[model samples]
Target chain A: MQFCVIGLGRFGQALAVALANKGHEVLAIDRDEQRVQEIEDRVSQTFILDSTNEKAMKSLGLSEFDWVIIAMSSDLEASILTTMIVKDAGAKRVCAKAATDLHAKILKKLGIDKVVFPEHEMGVRLAEILSSPSIFQFLELAEDYSIAEISSPREFWDKTIRETDARKRYGINIIAIKRKEPYTDEKTGNIDYREELIMAPEPSQKILQGDILVVLGHNKNISKLEKATR
Target chain B: MKQEEIEHLLEEAKFYILNNRFEEAEKYLEKLLKEHPQNIEALFYMGLLNELLNRLTEAREYYEKVIELSPNHEGALEHLSRLQGK
Candidate 1:
């Protein structure tokens, strides 16, 4: 896959580098020479040109890229103009970052394929982490639905999935279980841990004390389950 | 069962629940409820057992029953209020 990221802010730079690390071709563009130089070695290509310049943007032939990302939320004019130029260039897909609600609405109005608020999402993630320390990871699928990884509550330490009755009781599904098993390294005479992931754990499988349960359910039910940990 | 025997059963259930032996607690509570359906202590303990097991709906129902029987029951009222707030 090929991706074109306009703007060299933290979010855009990270996205470009990550995509490149995943073996995708990434073209990182920014008007600042230093910003472009910092990431030039990490991505497939880097260019220092004002993205608002339609001629320069069109000259890159962005239409051939798999996706174009407008990541200049601080400069709304530049972000919007870049999005328009990318769309006019007939890019396959376009995703833009919005600094505020109104910016998001305008991006949507512009028919952007996707609009994201990285700062807002980070704030939400931080709040959830602080409120539910037992939750190792959480992904909100929708307003009322989420998938979370939480440590098994004490009451469920030795209980099998069937006994716990998680689905019927809390209206949540335990989709996976992650456990760490310790083994003595014969050669080194030291203990090492191996991670085991159980996908679609069976009803008879017992939940161990240190197991991490990956659950999917409504947000309210997930919160109820989290409260059970206390 | 005699009043003393009913009290004994509720005590045993409470003990099991405190020790996190929810299955045993549930058994005792179930037995007490069968013989003394209106026993406030038995109903409250059953509600606590359900709450521990994250069977919130069932816990709420049990708590509601206790409140129905004894309007001024502190434990039942508190537990039900907390569950409802969730």
Candidate 2:
């Protein structure tokens, strides 16, 4: 896919690098000369011109790209203006970076294809890890829904995966397991026995102590798992 | 190796922080760091927690670490300067 990313901040630069690395054709643009130079080698092309300038966007032949991403995360005016210009310039898909809920709402209202909240998104992820230690990971699916990976609490230890009635009672589907294995000493060259759990396991699979259970369910259900296990 | 998992964790952490659940937010961040020690999101919020609790030295450490990881990290630089009595 061809991608045009505007605003060469950290987030934008990272996204461009990742996408380009994935073999996609990427055109990275920013008003800052230094920022443009930073991504020069990582992308198919680099531009130091302001994306908000319709003339500049058109001159660059942005219409040839399949997708345009406006990444001016901190500058609302620049982001909005850039989005409008990209759309007017005939980009097939336009994605924008938003700094606030209001900013996102406005961008959506303006018909930007996608609105990303990089800072807010990062903040929420770190918050989850702090709130539920038993839950190794979690993702909000919607307002009331979520998917979580939780450590098997003491109560579930030695029980078979089906015994918990996870799907029936907690509305959680066990997705996978993360197990810690014993390390071998280079001198002794000994392999020690270690515990492991079957991931996306069958109903008959057993749940052992210290096993991390990857699960998917509603937020409330996940919380119940967290409290019960912890 | 889906980025979604890491992204999801960061989102939840931010919500908890906004809700004033400092302790809860800290728990999530710690776990995240254990898995991905170099995660910028986890590092940034650890700084936030220290700053909020008035543990200026610790907060400064985290903020400085963030700048080290991403030199152009405006947020970290801004907060670190504030914490340093600048």
Candidate 3:
């Protein structure tokens, strides 16, 4: 696969590096010579070019690349113009970053369907994390399946894994347990806590208060447990 | 080759997918992909068609290909993320 990224900002650099690491050929471009220099070694190729300039942009032959990503997030005008230039240059697939909902709407209206809002997406995920404090972490697996680490619900305190019947009732498997052990520091004479993880514990493993339940299952079932614990 | 022609073929593949004609959808998508191998929509729909047929690994392959060709595609990333259980 060949990818042409038209901005070498943080997001663009990350995307280019990730794609390049995946063994894909990537052309990383930016108007800033410094930014282009920063990512020159990370991606397949680097260029300092003004993407909004139709003449210069068209010279890149964006159509030959499998994808052209317009990632000028800070400059709305430049981003929009670059999107237009790429499309007009006969690029088959183009994805662009929009600064806001209004920006996204405008991009959509222009028939660019692959507009992304990185900050907005990250904000939503952060909000989800904030709202679900008991869910220590959430990792998506395959379609409909996820593995999540969540603090055990109060109701499950002191109960065995079998007693909770999480596997039977919610169709979720408890993969591990994380417990905090308190210890007093010898030199400082202060009490601290250390996390201990038990992997694939026996069904009889006791669930103590503050124990973090590591579970794996379908998203629906995991959500049931995630919400139930809340 | 032309925009309208490619779109027409995409619609045909979409119709087959919606109608549960898995083989037909695959056939149409394969032909479209042969012409434009990096077509994002075709690869994404091919992922969907594979998912419907219970070929999850194949679905992940197609979705990952779409993401490789075009990063951060919402549907492709969402579906591909779900398959990575670890």
| Highest lDDT against the true fold, candidate | 1
- Candidate 2 chain B has its poorest 10 consecutive residues by lDDT at B48-57
Tens-digit lDDT track for model 2 on A108-214? 99898888887886677668866765555667666677777676766666678789788887778888876534333356432122446566788888765446788
The CAPRI class of candidate 1 is: incorrect
Q: Between prediction 2 and prediction 3, which has the larger lDDT? A: 3
lDDT of model 1 at residue A20? 98
* Cand. 1 Cα-lDDT: 0.84
lDDT of candidate 2? 0.76
Weakest 10 consecutive residues, lDDT, candidate 3 chain A? A184-193
Tens-place lDDT digits, model 3, residues A1-230: 99998898889989999999999999999989999998799888888988888999888888899888888778889888888888899998888888998999988877785888878766754654566656657766654677888767766777899898888888999999887554444674322245689999899998875577899998788778877765
TM-score of chain B of each: 0.93, 0.90, 0.92
lDDT of 3 by residue, B1-86 (tens): 88998989987876665544556778888988999999998998888766544355688999999999889787788778776851
- Chain A TM-score per candidate? 0.91, 0.90, 0.69
Candidate achieving the largest TM-score: 1
Lowest lDDT 10-mer window, candidate 1 chain A?
A184-193
Model no. 2, DockQ: 0.02
Off by over 4 Å in 3: A138-148, A154-224, B1-86
